[model samples]
Target: MTDQIVPDSEHRGLVARLPQVPRDLAQLARFDRPIGWWLLFWPCAFGLWLAGAGWQIGLLLWLLLGAVAMRGAGCVYNDIVDADLDRQVARTAVRPVASGRISQTLAWAWLGALCAVGLIVLFQLRWQAQVVALASLALVAAYPFMKRITWWPQAWLGLVFSWGAPVGWIALRGDNWEVLAALYAGCVLWVIGYDTIYALQDREDDALVGIRSSALRLGGRVRGGVTVFYLGALALWGLAFWLLRADWVALLALVPAALHLGWQVASLDPADPANPLERFRANRWAGALVAAACYVVGNA
Candidate 1:
């Protein structure tokens, strides 16, 4: 079998060097794709920083590890549930579960291992945060089914993926629930925007296979849809910053992220195969810019 993944997948050279078993494992957990973890980690960072816990290096590192492990676990679970659907999608047909490189039994074991790491990270947080984190399990478990049932699974993903925003804030301090609510709301809109970009890569396959996605829902209006979502994210973030510190300088901290989002919207091309994935992957930097804004507003 060819060792290559889809054209848009990154870390190809690194993945190519790994042995077969490790490679299969890597594919199962999507370890070769760092963007998922980065997206997941950003919400945690935003929450921590926005709660004035940015200086907690140890906590931050723990959250990063948790993001990696939990994101992997989520991917494993999604692959398991979507194996048949994945076999129908060209890009996902080569996935470990879909390709039969990894059995469902082994995949379940791997998911458990990853969740064990997440549990360790959970132990590090306050009980309030722990409870908040655990509350997301049902949502995560149900996510794969959303694409089967709804035209807006990306909306569900936004809720599940942005969960760390609340966890990070509650872990440090439970006050200012308003700010945390705004931050989580902004992160959800941000996820919806980017995931819509990602769903563009699969619009044709998804439509043919009866899989619903935001890309299919928006169709030619995808760029406009993303623009609205991004604009909503910025607005909510601005509101959060205002609530935190009602100063012009605090709100200005969002400028870099605003510019980056604008670039993404302006340059988006749904018809171009590579355009969507490239724009989707660029959210890692978008996440960083948001994290920076959080730190500046919450601490500076």
Candidate 2:
């Protein structure tokens, strides 16, 4: 049963210690892979920091909790929806839902619990932010079907995952919709680029299963496609900085993040089985760099 753990689980030891049912539930929510939550949390931080909410540690912590719970809920929902597709993909075939380790009923119950946690976090924000956050539900609900209907599901995911930016911005201040728009747009592109890297791991299986992704659409030009997206993200972020501060010094804040993204693209190896996941996971740091840049530009 321990062997059923997914290959990329970062906390296999912790997950392996759980009882069978609990372990399967944890696997269903992808609790062992913290990357998803981190990715989800960063845009929140980007929005908060860029909105000049200086070190609202308590609010940030609450948002972190929300990120964890909501990311888990999203994964559970995704697994429930994608179980049939998962069964066809080599990497996802052993997933708890697809492998029959967990039932859809149990998964829905778990999703409800996770969303309950998210609901608590939702109350921590202002009413405007609450509405913005609630508005994301429709996007979240639609995401599972994007790959079925379009080649750019990652673009839809970008919309879903980058939503936190607006919520965070609204929570801190109501004005500067232009700044929020630029920041949110950058976050969307960043998600599309990193997720495209992640999708590389499943290209063969996804093609066989008739699933669509930016990775499949780019084909041999995946590196270039990611490069274009990353460059677009940086350009938009730069525009956000200019709109807010109008300083070349403020634009300089983006340098570190730009260099990091450049490294990810320049070093990317799509053909190497291990390489894409490595690069994909590295976006956690990439996101952190951008967050730090946001902090600098917004606070300094």
Candidate 3:
């Protein structure tokens, strides 16, 4: 109900499932962070709608289900890999695994269960969408390690998170590769932009812990870097719409989301951590606006 981020006091309910559930294991899935699932689900829906798959309500529901299960699964996988690092980060210190609430073995079991649900949803997709969905496994598997290897792991996350756009497009159209690619690329940049903002919250903690992230790498240039990513998102998304519909009005659909991102960049304050997190969370709205634009343009 409240839009607060994952660590909120009320969010404890997410891990409150049972005397049955090991408290540590419950936390590992980040059941408290439903926003993660919502963020993941929306893109898939946007892709389905943009591809004119709105007629298939059943497919949309299944895709939504897939997003929830898979996002949870992804988080589990991520926690398993980052248990030690997460303990080092201020924000992640309370996480089930990092806090010793859950064991690695139990975490793996939870992951398998989440993936089973994901597989059920996967079977509902067309073969192309299924393959597309499955292809992301490697990307997802590798993501937790990316932060260890590169400052730009957010870019990698964008690819993993945005894979839904292409699969959604192909699920209906079988393959509008160019349009899908543009959307996917735009989403990658968008993730980079937003995640950089999120990374700001952990910049000090991350650095102290010996972790690497764009938030630390960008340093004073955080604003400029995010601006580039946001602007690039606008351009690519505009192109995606143009190629799909070839109309000026269709291009106009991106205006609102563009303006939103503009406001975010314009008001950004590098000295203040709150500003970035606010901007990062507001991206849910940005994604919605783009989805609407895509739908109007694609259906027009």
Alpha-carbon RMSD, each predicted model: 1.0, 0.7, 3.0
- Give one digit per residue, the lDDT tens place, for model 2 in 7-66: 999999999999999998888888999999999999999999998869889988998999
1 versus 2: better TM-score goes to: 2
Q: What TM-score goes with each of the models?
A: 0.98, 0.99, 0.92
lDDT of 1 by residue, 24-76 (tens): 78877888899999999999999999998557899999999999999999999
User: Rank by TM-score, descending?
Assistant: 2, 1, 3
Error of 2 at 8 (Å): 1.1
Please identify model 3 stretches exceeding 4 Å from their true place: 1-26
- Model 2: what TM-score? 0.99
User: In angstroms, how far off is 179's CA in candidate 1?
Assistant: 0.6
lDDT (tens digit, per residue) of candidate 3 on 1-300? 222224533365544544534545555665665566767866776677788645467887898788888888998898888988987777787777776667788888999999999999988877988998899999999999998889889988888888888878888886667888888888889888988888888888888888888989999999999999999988998888887877787788889989999998898876775676677777888878887887777776
Residue 30 in model 2: shift from native, Å?
A: 1.1
lDDT of each: 0.92, 0.93, 0.80
Give the top-scoring candidate (TM-score): 2
Candidate 1, residue 269: CA error in Å?
Answer: 1.0
Q: Which residue pairs overlap in candidate 3's backbone?
A: 24-101, 24-102
Better of 1 and 2 by lDDT: 2
**Sequence-dependent TM-score of model 3:** 0.92
